[model samples]
Target: MASSNSLLSEMQFLCPICLDVFTRPVSTPCGHNFCMSCITCYWNDTPVCQCPICKETFEKRPDLKVNTFISELASQFMSLQVTDAHIWSADQQKASCGGAVLCDICTNTKQEAVKSCLECQTSYCDVHLEPHHRATGLKRHTLVDPLASLENMICKEHTRLLMLFCKNDQVLLCDVCAISRHVNHDVISMQQAYKEMKALLGDTEAKVQQMIQERLQKVQAMNESVKQSVTETKDVIANGVQDLTTLVSEIQKSQKELVKVMEEKQKEAEEQADEFISGMKQEITELQKTMMKLRELKQTEDQLCFLQSFPNSSLLPHTMDLSTFSFNRHAEIQHIRKSLSKSVSELKMLLNKMNTEIQKFSDDTDVSNNTMLRYMQQFEVDIVLDPDTAHPLLTLSDDGKQVKYSMGSGLWGIQNLNPNMFTEHLAVLGQRGFSSCRFYFEVFVGGKTEWCLGVATASVQRRGALVRGPGCGLWAIWFLEDKFETFSSPNVPVHFGKPERIGVFVDYNGGQIYFYDRQTATLIYCFTECFFTEELYPYFNPCDNEYGSNLDPLIIVPVSRME
Candidate 1:
């Protein structure tokens, strides 16, 4: 029996279909043996009956017959190996009892699986997994954790394990897929792709955090601005209320003064009436006594006394002559009325002056236009001449800081005008142009008899007679002869004195241009609500030189700091 068991162990009695000892062994016409049920099932699943091991074909269906001799041999082999198989199974169960994945091969007692083989797409217990670790054929199979869903890790189209990443398609690919459909695509190892994607995710996370911080900062700044705006609004309201209160108090004081004067005039008139009534009453009392004495003398008992009293009528009160008691009310009140009228006129003058002052206060804070210009001087710009835009007759200094008209020698010396020159106007534009900010420049017109200086938009005509007015995109003031004038629609005259150094301020955002006398800090003129759409340049015209009368150059002056 020992000799038979040793021979059976060396013999090949395992079926290729089940990889185990064959049960109910059968033989076909091709002379290959297999389990009867396994052969039938294989043939039924295929188009033709063929041997699985040798690839031998059968032309016709052949009746299967049990190979009794091989069956007995396989039964004896299984019985002999039973003790060793039981021992191996027991060892595998003991080794894998703690794991979650149960081995598929351990039928009698299910045990935990140690590793999953990608090539077989099956999980195996430690005992069954020994083939992958020891055998050369199974050693090359990929192993991983005992995964629950091995199907998810497989390529459905190729029915192969996914082991690569296709960068072109941004998808996971199997080895066969990478070689076939994705051969020309960018592909990388799965591990390498995973590391790169993790790095990218970390970078993205950092950027998102930075963006969050930036937005939070913006929110905080906006909140602060809102708070500041509210605070400023409250302060403005409080100041305005205080000013109005002061004005009201002034009006109340004027009213009291007016009432006091009127009351004094009325009291004087009442005192005059009271004095007239008292004089009339004293005269009446004297007349009543004279009449009582006259009646006593008329009784004839005192005829002599009556004659004596009548004889001295001039000595008694003159009852018939009431001229001394007459009240000239108009004469009494005329002086008071005249005084009240004068007081009213003076009060009206005071109110008028106050109204004018209040109007001035309402229009602008204590700061005058000159003060505003001084404030704007902080944004003063250094202006230079642009020779390209100057008229042919105009000569520019080497430093481009001054320009003056120069007529070439003859009485009517006509110089050839270039296309870039201002043909009809003796105008030159500054080198720098501004479109959206505040800028100021000063031009010295000290000895020039006639000159024009201000800002002009880029669209102003360069070759023809350019209208120096707001409608033509030119906001300017001019000094001609002895008069100062602003080039408005109708050329309004400016009453301000001539300024040797004229400061031109342009506020593009505010749409205004202000002219100032830098020497006296006085405003010459201002062009308000100016519609500026393009770049603005400082415009200067010395007005044809005037036969040496206006020969002085228009010099661009530097702004000086205030003390």
Candidate 2:
């Protein structure tokens, strides 16, 4: 029966190519072995090389990496000296005799010392050794037994037998080795080669394991850096978005002013054209009527006899009066002409001023906001500017009343546009607060609703509102369909009572408007966050336009029959 070591030796240690031992060996995908450089040289010469085991053609040679650990293990196993198990057992029983010398032939175990000679196959006490040496001067008597003698044998070029042990040769070579091919090369006996290689095995294994462990740690560190880079990419995109929003606000403001200037100037120009055209039309109509009457008098029967009697002198005077015509222009027309000219000149001047103002706003579009809220961005939001250690973000207000019309905290929520489309929100930062608490706002877009997250947020102020401020929380509304409740309080910003003010407008955009606590800039729970602004009824519009009376958010929910 083959031992496990012998089976493993055949499986992993032996290289199929060469077969003597694995030397600089490498394994293929088909589990066949070849020397590293041997395979590369083979494939480089041959365009496609087929694997020996599977006959699978490989288009390219893989990288040549050393399998040094397994190769070293193979070399160590080939050099050991050992014995047959059954012979060792029999020898052990014979060696038990007292005063008998143990054979130095096979095993490393102990027995009584005996003077043993292998050629005679005789074991003798040290006193009996003198008789055999004097007889015939025997030449073939090996002093040592078979086990130790096996190490001394060498190969000869002529006989090629295990004989002629070479003292200078280091390796067991065939009889051909001592020919001219090895004329000057130094060599030693087979015993010397085995001794040297066996001693180096322990040190080789330690070095291989240390190298593999170090490389694996390097691969792991590289993967962690890849994950960190993904986080940084997200931060850059979020900052870009905030910058775009600010730019859009400035653009809308400049556009509104431009439209106002153009409309005023256009109206004045049209008025001037209409007044000049109307007076010219009246004079042209009167001249046509006078020419028609003169034709009637010349053709009439009553005037025909008088025309014949008057002769050439009367006809000349009539024709003369017809050719010459004039009128005194009223001061009203003159005054209108002067007034219209002045109006146009003023309109042109206003247009020039507007163009300059627009350029100023456009140039400031890239204004940078360094004051950012630092925090890890949640799923809904994109950018988080949270520092390692900063005070908890204050989203709440003290007394939780940031919506007190124009009275409390000096916060007057004014619309920048007609519908307040372009508006800014301010928040009174709250104190140390729980993470779950959030802000609420009521919107009135045709009806009452809420603002979306991130779309509505606190003002730029980071400090908690201990003193009177913009009250920290501001929800700008168009109040187009609805209106703002008009009322004021001295220090308290929020209207504590029922929503009763001049205009009651709800923020309605399907969004969340966070009215933070002014004291610490932290969001208040249920006290100040309002969702439905329609609760403040009897709403009055803020704009002074005649159509302001039509302030009613048109809300309609048409229902279908349920199946």
Candidate 3:
């Protein structure tokens, strides 16, 4: 019995089709477990012998190696069950008086009826069950052992069945589990567990690879970007270094030029200083000579006093002897006085001559031109943005001092031009040369129309007056009325000389010009039509409180008025 149990445990006893104890052992082409009755029933009574698990058909039946071990184990299990049933109360009721439990098939009919067979594990009435259990050759028909049915089953956990599996941690454990134990434990659906796990593992693997690949690409791109940035930075720094070096060189050159000029100025000053000192020294020498002359005069006067003091009383009392001495001495004193006067006069003339020569040498250089170096091109006129032949030029702000410029050509304004004033004011052009107002919007007025426009004195008075020269009045751009009754100021203000598209873009005070968009303002366009332009050469700025040249705009763009 032990050998039979051991062999049955090694042999696979259950039929594949029934998943139960084999009904009739049979062999397939693969020599695996099968039951003749089970396979034949599923084969639809066909002659084909096929492997049930894979459906691989065989042309001929393989030799049936009836597993003696499985047969013996089955017989032993059945016999043990039957023998145990003889002691049962239900089986004892149907036993013979000799203690033999007889099948009703071999026993006599009793008044009491018995139905179920304990040993056969079947139910029947006393009339059939007794006979069924008592059938001579088939009394030992197989009965299942319930307790042994599940004894050999093992769980996926490699433990006993009826156990729990933790999901998060992928671990199987016994039934004494707490929430803490399963907090990170792997649990699963017990019935469809393997199929679910296969799908889950495949999905996880694919997702992990995808994420890793995405991150890898990102890292690579970042590294490349960093490298490019580093290269660009290096280039920028190199450019900066070059610019710095150039600036330093330029500064050094300027410094050298400055030093050279300064030294030349210092030399001139030194020469002047030396000339001044020499003159002073010469004056000092003359003073010393004059002092010597004065001392001599004092000595001669003392001598004369001494001679007079030994007077006429002691000598001959105003008489003949005294007359001789007085005559001789008087003539000598007169000669000495004449000599001293001549010497003093000569010294004065010498001092005066030296002072005159020194002054002539000192006043040699002209300081005006060199000091005002920046104002070198005092007469150069810059033709900023030309007269607008395109759209209307609108001046945003003009105080006749400074102008704000904007070109509202699109939804927004852009391309700003900045404030630039002429060294000589240009608000009124032709301050030096003549300027022509040819036509305003291409409306031609016949003949030599001379529009002498000038800014005359306004009540407020313009601040930075530019055209303040003789023959010019207040700040204005007026067109000369060729006809006696010509109301050109109000009628045809602008003349571009011919019938052409021209726009006025300026505020007199703000000094701005808008030569681009037409939709911004009609006032500016009206002013343009009012512009009285005349052709003249060498225009002069009159000495009146007239127009000043102040302008504003950072960048300027021109547009066609017609377009």
Candidate 4:
């Protein structure tokens, strides 16, 4: 059976083209066997139809088909090969031993060692190790994990195991060395020395871990600082661009107005000169007509005619003396020219002094606070709380401008049946919704240890626990656990001093939300590139009243303009 199996395992089942066991064994007309795919691929690559092994040619490419008999035999041969692979023998077992240390006592088929004896200086397999466990004499010897070489553990000079530790020299010593050269040294057992060194190493490891933690914290701090610096720098550049652009526009406008003023002055002077010239031309024409009449009378057979036509002196026009008729062309615009000259000189002085003004603008930390707040104040709206949207345990003031978390039932024991009312969270929305380009409002959070303020879309979820963020139609910041953070995915912490009043400003068209410390006019944070498709209402939450720490009401105070 073995001989027959060996003969079947020969190259008879292999494909002549692929030189391996046939996958889908096929036969050609010339009686040659090959893998079906290999023959097909080979035929497709070459123009001529021929067999790869025999080089036999065919007139037309014959349709190749898998040979079931050869294919079944190939399949049986593959199975036989797999079966033989699992039959492990002693030689295979020896090869499988890998690089482990083998028993020194076993002459044939050595087994892997489990332990090494210090006294015998030899490694032993589990079977051979049984003697040391049973024998009283060998039981006294020390056994350790197998070592490739036991020479290192023995003292070179004493030819004995180093079993003691000398503290003075900080070295391992043998039994003979302990009483010889190391006799005067501070000696102790090796186990005790190991315990002490391990304890010291643990302390060093703890210190290293603490240093790593400190450095990690410092890295986080530096990263945060870099982020803050980048944000501030971008803000500064944007503000500088806006300010400089506005300044340039104002300069251009002033220049246009100045040019108009000078042109008007010149036009007035030209009109006055034209009127004087017209009067002088009319006088000259009248004088010439009078002279022509007198000449005709002097030659005259027309003396009677001249006396009849000549003269009612009251009807003749009177001419002014040439010396007294003086027109000062420069006089008409003289005052205007003087004013323009003075203005130009002053403008030059201002241009030269612009360095200080620019420096002041750069040094002004509160410039944005004042400028932005003052502009945003123009769009300020009076925000009043909506009782319809107030949570069940929330109380609204009579003026609808303040809200607080109620300890017991709602205010006046009136249950709100409104569909828009919040059923879970201690929150309320503004009575009026804003849909304009921009809006501003302020909320006084004084004496309150916990609060939330911002704007929410009109379609915000009110019946259940509301998730906070743009995705939930809410863009807000809150103070909780004595820390300020935005209600974003992985909430971002805001580093700023607490303010009594928070000013919320929204630029709907620009998709931005800004929170300001109203007291100091400081910009606390801004949410940029937000999407506001629908009307938004002011959102407020005064936290719970269970803890006396947050009993203060959140008031919607009127915005005060800052100049």
Candidate 5:
């Protein structure tokens, strides 16, 4: 049985046309056997009937019959091949299970290849791979995993394994190519190049992660800003609604009072007309009674009786003087209407004038406070107060940007007084003076009850009892008793809300000084048509301490540029 199995393994059981174990063996008249379907298809495609092995032609197509003996032999050979494959390693059995590389040596049955020999450029199943492990010459052959294509792993030019990389050419190289053509082309081992590429990839990944985190933080910040903006918008809408509702209510109340006054005037005119009518009717009744008595006297035919009963010819019955009495109901009502109409016309004119100013203010409100302030900040100057020009009762900050009233009056030691010192006024001037061009600065006035701010001419008097006004060469505004006043010729009152910060802008060529509420961006006051003949300096006054009521320092805040 063993010798028979060996002979069967050596026997060629594969059909020449299909190159596989025959499904049904057939014998032609020429005595050659092939797969039944394969020979039939081959004969149908040819012009003449012939034997594939002997090249013998036949006049007529020969009838074919299945060779049962040969079919049985092919089936036995297939069974034997599978039994031999099962004896191989378990890994080879699994590899040959499905979709595995077929061994080139197996003739009757398909067997999965376990390894590929690079030297022979051929794949071997475990059954055929035994020679490589046992034979001395075959053991030196390089083997790798089963590969379908080996051309890609070899350098096409040198026909050798690609073991090196040419950095300059960005291509694979073999040892022979590296020494002959790529010697000076930055050649490096494939392993070395892989390490460098992996390190670079790791660094790139880190940078990408950092960029992602930064973007996420920016998105979070932007979302928060949007939320804050939404909150502020809602607050503004609520305040506007409340203020408008109050104004409308007051207007309605005034209209009701106007209606009540007109109604009262109408009621008075009606009452006076009723009194006049009553008097006239009483007079008519008395006249009618006198007429009836005269008729009775006439019927008696007694002239004496009639003449005695009649009212005296010289003395008529007492009655109202109708000729002199005149009640013009319409005239009184008309006079009231005319008076009200004149007043209403004047009121409308005043209301329209007020509306014009309100519209202007509303237009200015369209620009946000930050926007307007940022615009003005472009012209901001670095102002430092001059110690020589500061008042004795005022304490200056080390940075020369703040000042406040000294709490202890006698704490200041007597020192050499300069001509620029303020002897009476608790004021200070900036160190830098502007003779031309425009300048702007901001001051924090919060927590202070009284303070003064403006620009003054350098030639102004710094002596005792300094007169504060333009006529005295000093232009300034001061807050006292909760009232804002500009120190002009006669001291004009300014109507404005309490401001926490004040921004002062001066147009030297235009000769104007403008004050603005920094928080609201609302215009506080403006001094126009001024003639400046000398250099101007920033002015500040903390006023009196008033037992700590006005002790908060006036800070010259730093300004930053905004885009």
Candidate 6:
């Protein structure tokens, strides 16, 4: 039986073209057996008729015949063989042990791995893993699910199971390694480390998602800001265009009126010239007629007759009115042109002022405040103290530029007091007054603890109690008891440091007053939309000396222009 099985296995019954058991086997002229259909299909595809296995050629295709004896022998052998149809296929072999993890102990015929031993760094099948479950020595091996790389489960240096995690070095460690190199480091079991690391990863992912959301919100806000800016810019452009168009129309109207005035003067001059020419022509014709009459009188030889005729003749013209014809030709036009020129000069000045305002709005430099101060300096006034407007308890300097509060029984005891003097409040007014233009002045309030400085209207109370506020015709900023405040409807607190020199600017036409710290050029406070029907004077109040704390005199300083 063994000899017959060996003989059947060694038989060559596969077709070379199909590489499988022959089907309808046929013998070619070269004695090579092949599947009849396989050879016929091969011959039909190629130009030369040849045996596939032997490469033997033929002039005409052979009439192939089946090998009956070989076919019968192959059929008998196939029937006698014990064929197992349920054998493992190639794919199944690869899934089990051919391509997957194989048992290390199954050296003769490798089998699929079932479990892995972390301690031994080896894999084993069910049959070979029995020792791990039975033997006490093998039972100590840490077993887990089958893995391809078991070597990674052991420490390379210590040759021991990596059962611990070293957090300081961020590496895996063994029990022996933990006691040696990682003894001082933070170490924990691998399971605990894995759980902690997974939790941290979750937190990191959440943070990344939150950051993405925040960026998206920022993008949306930026888009909204851009849209609003574009809208506002368009509105500004439209308004500017309208304003320019209106200005051009006004200029054109003024130009036409000026030209009309000049044209009228020119027409009057031409009319005067026509009247002068007509008068001269009539005189010339009368003279010619008189000469003809004289020649006729000479023919009559009578001088007396000629003299009498000349006195009564129509040729003799009456005294002509030359004064009208001798009038200045350029007088009318000159007067009109001068008036037009003056109007144009005023318009030029207005345009220059408008240009300056536009430049102020467009300038983007840090020196804008300084530039404003310099411009305001042109309106600087030399402020002097008015003794008549000062409180009787206040003392003024000889130069009338400084004043301070006097605590004595007052000037009423020494000299006659002015009725207009501030008798209740320790305040004083400047000598000069402004009614319409802008003016700026600075006061040195250094070393003063309590003081007030600003502008006051002419009608401000001078005799009894006084109200220190804008509504009461007083616009001022005061420093009292370490607090800075501005006088308004309701006193407003000013957030500013103590300044040595205080600048006061009053624009009567603009109905505004501004206070500034001269040293830093920083705005301290402003009074806007103030109604001033009378003249305004710079007001100063050096509060009563409280134990000499407010002794420093309120000195009026000159404004220094910045280059």
Best by lDDT: 4
lDDT (C-alpha) at residue 497 in model 1: 64
Q: In candidate 6, what are the lDDT values of residues 1-563, reduced to their tens digit?
A: 33665565536766788876677888988889888899989999999998777788999999998888777766665655434322335456655663578899997999999998887888999999999999999887778878776798878887677889999999999899999998899999999999999999999989999988878866886788699979988998899889988999999987897788668877887887888788789987987877786677768757776666655545455647666457686786688779878988998998898788678757854357767677777889889888888886788887888888666543323213898788888889998889989999999998788898888888888878876544787888887655579765335677547788888888998778988788887777887657789999999999976635786789998787755
Best-to-worst ranking by TM-score: 4, 6, 1, 5, 3, 2
Clashes of each: 0, 72, 88, 0, 0, 0
Winner by lDDT between candidate 6 and candidate 4: 4
lDDT of 2: 0.39
Q: What TM-score would you give candidate 4 relative to the actual structure?
A: 0.40
- lDDT ranking from best to worst? 4, 6, 5, 1, 3, 2
Error of 4 at 123 (Å): 3.7
Off by over 4 Å in 5: 1-372, 407-416, 489-491, 546-548, 560-563
Per-residue lDDT of model 5, residues 83-106, tens digit only: 766666556766656357778788
Candidate 1 structure quality by residue, lDDT tens digits, 147-178: 65677787788767788999999999998888
In candidate 6, list every pair of residues with a backbone clash.
none
Return the TM-score for each candidate structure: 0.35, 0.23, 0.24, 0.40, 0.34, 0.39
lDDT of candidate 3 over 77-113, digit per residue (tens): 5566556565574665744333322333434553222
Per-residue lDDT of candidate 2, residues 435-522 (tens digit): 2232222212232221111122222323443222223233332222222221212233332221111111122332233222222223
For candidate 5, the 10 contiguous residues with the lowest summed lDDT are 407-416
Prediction 4 global C-alpha lDDT: 0.81
Candidate 6 vs. true structure, TM-score? 0.39
**Candidate models: Cα lDDT each:** 0.78, 0.39, 0.41, 0.81, 0.80, 0.80
Which residue segments of model 1 deviate by more than 4 Å?
A: 1-370, 409-417, 468-470
Instruction: Give candidate 5's TM-score.
Output: 0.34
